[model samples]
Target: MNKKTQLGVPLSAQNRLFVPVLGASGGCGRSTTAGLLACFLAAVGSSVVLDTAPRLTSPWPSWPTEHGAGLASVPPGRPLTRHQAHAAASRSDGPAGKWSVLTDHQDWSHGPLDLPTDPAAWYQLAATGAWQAVVADTCHPVAHDIVAARTKGQRGLTAAWCALPFAVPVLCAPTSGTGVAALQTAVKAITAEGLPLQRMVVVLTATGEGRTPPVVKAAATMLESQVSAVLQMPFDPHIRVHGLSDADRLARQTVAVGSALVSAVLASAHHTWGDPLPPAPVPAVLSRTAVDSRSARPAHHEGVFT
Candidate 1:
């Protein structure tokens, strides 16, 4: 890696969060949801997006070939100076404020590619007050390992998506009955892994879709009884690889989905930290309530990780 010509102080943060988006399969929209959610989180307030998608190049935005350190590139226990941490993260135009990405370093071909990042490192970085949230785009088979590593021995971590394989059997089920059954089976599978069902929120996305099938909605309704929340991704034809576009006009409905996701994330944060989120912009729906219930305090383990 080449030396960054302009390293600077990290942005001051009022609080921090870590949201890992995981799915059972590749096309489950985990990365897309994560990227967009990260952008929305940033637009609403200060945040850092961590791109851990196992791809040749990031599915979100591309960091310049001559770029600074990736968040994953930081060595264990080696604290980053404010400037170094900022250089390690950047936005589309250049290194800037809270709205930035810390992509995987391009050297994983020979290193540990499938491993989840160390939670201690993440904890240390979060402790620095440089970001309000760290949204991670991750996939399964490996996603569980990441969750286990992060959750190991740490109680009440306030992390979301515990064992949410994010399966879409319902999406392919031939009938409404089959779809609901499939979703139930998938939920059972996740619980068998000893993951807290209450911490999980299943998000369903579509392909070339303008509307969700009635069967799928039925499946989601069934899932709502089993999990804390169930969300649907709004189909937007304009979604691009570069990132969630601020330049284009997003539909009112799509904006609502983003708002719900933000509130869910905040609810988890509040549950874990036992404190109100710092001042940040919120959607109209969320301004009234953040989530269905003040997420019951840390059901998995005692004491919060943050």
Candidate 2:
């Protein structure tokens, strides 16, 4: 494979690639997949994981971060500067690489966070950050979102992300009969809406250690010709016990699964947009003395937030 292909580089510096990992249903390892995807992508270029899950439910705020104001600090309606966007994100480093996470930071004692419901607003905020890749951990059920968007004339967040240019969606499901059924339904709905089914990657995640379920194996066989690729992610005990707080503790096989998923995403983008993906231009901010002082240091030397 070409180095560029392996890295999942964007086709243009101006065109940011958005990878939304949408689950067929809840408890489908959506957040785990998103975090790992961002980790691997960060190895090649600037990347961030946007926690699109609702307030109070997102796991990002609990994860360790270098520095950030949290997503709640983002001002509404005003244009977001790259500095502002970067500041609102909590940065973290691990074995895979460095990546930032933007998620709700409000405490339960406070009133509910007023997160933007308009999908365009979220996209704009991410684009303004100038991140090369964005891994969105979408919370809603995607098949239902597609139906709602089509029938009610309302734009669903997952649908909007999938429709964006340079999008490579990862649809996840558990390796169980019910999970496979939900995934099948989601694929059908995505296809019916005239979306890019060819660019979709289906991930069947194991919730616990066991042999591959017959239903999951059958689903993979049937979906092989439909989507971009079908991958099985083995269960990681660390994630089950401690959640995604520490990437370094993730099992090696789990990390390998993430690498495969990233490769599939890059291949999908290449097929959809035709590559050698153009190299991203250096950000003007890097030319400034202050930005250079902060960003020019070696990755390992950067200070970590306790």
Candidate 3:
């Protein structure tokens, strides 16, 4: 560890990737593919931070005044309703540098029991400073109390309170056979509610409208080996301009299948195992030549160690 302190710590900092965009059910588009993959990783500069897991409804851009900064909301059994406070005071007129959308906790629906028992002090205040990337349009299907409040407290500080190491659960089934018995009963209810089956993946969203390839290899053998990888999004037309337009419309949206999923999430951002793999397993319908060959390469992903 010497060489001017190992060349001033480089080697890509041992891999730093944290993209969470699961959705094989509640809208296969996963927040319009995480808002066009966070506008193609901030249009190639990369300083993204689009979090969301507390309870759901906080897509970012709603706090014009109901309570102001610190975005509030405590609605469930009653008491704590403030929710957006004018979207945290318009994130203080964001856009001076960009990348910093961390709404501590406000309730999206009941996800991870509205986690917030100190998520690494809001993930070190949202990975402070020179941000690299952080996209997180998550919520839907995998929600074991927000994966135990994101691995809570000292487990070495639970992925350093949001630095995360593995939480990619995208399984939007429906290729038939009752969507392979509801994706094998949701992988036996997340491996009998224990979690971490080598950090599962399993994707198969809207295959366009042709359903073949043995129905995507019989839903990848129904999560046989507790699923490690599988993705295939066939139906394209720029993914049907995301449910008839909410915003983006670049001639139809498939900016090269969302820029090959933001270049496979910036080539798996350093890779200490935080997010990347889970986008191949289709057949609820698709064909236009397999949606033009899954928008030409960058098909599903796979991982376990490196």
Indicate which candidate wins on TM-score: 2
Question: Model 1 off-target regions past 4 Å?
Answer: 1-14, 55-57, 61-77, 92-98, 105-116, 142-186, 240-251, 271-306
After the best TM-score superposition of candidate 2, give how far the Cα of residue 193 lies from its true spot, in angstroms: 1.3
Candidate 2 lDDT by residue in tens digits, 121-167: 56666766878788888888988888988888876677788876578
How many backbone collisions does model 2 have?
0
Give the distance in Å from residue 202's predicted Cα in candidate 2 to where it truly belongs.
Answer: 0.9
lDDT of 3 by residue, 37-155 (tens): 55545443333444455534544443211222332431221211113222332221111122334444434443453444343323222232223344565554543333454467323
Best by lDDT: 2
Q: RMSD for each model, in Å, please?
A: 12.8, 7.6, 21.9
Show the colliding residue pairs in model 2. none
TM-score of each candidate structure, all chains considered together: 0.62, 0.85, 0.26
Tell me how far the alpha carbon of residue 82 in candidate 3 is from the true structure, in angstroms, after superposition. Answer: 7.0
The order of the candidates by lDDT, greatest first, is 2, 1, 3
lDDT of 1 by residue, 55-168 (tens): 464554453223556655554333344465666665642122225666666554645444344444443443342565566665443334434645684422222233212111
Better of 1 and 3 by lDDT: 1
RMSD, model 2, all Cα superposed? 7.6
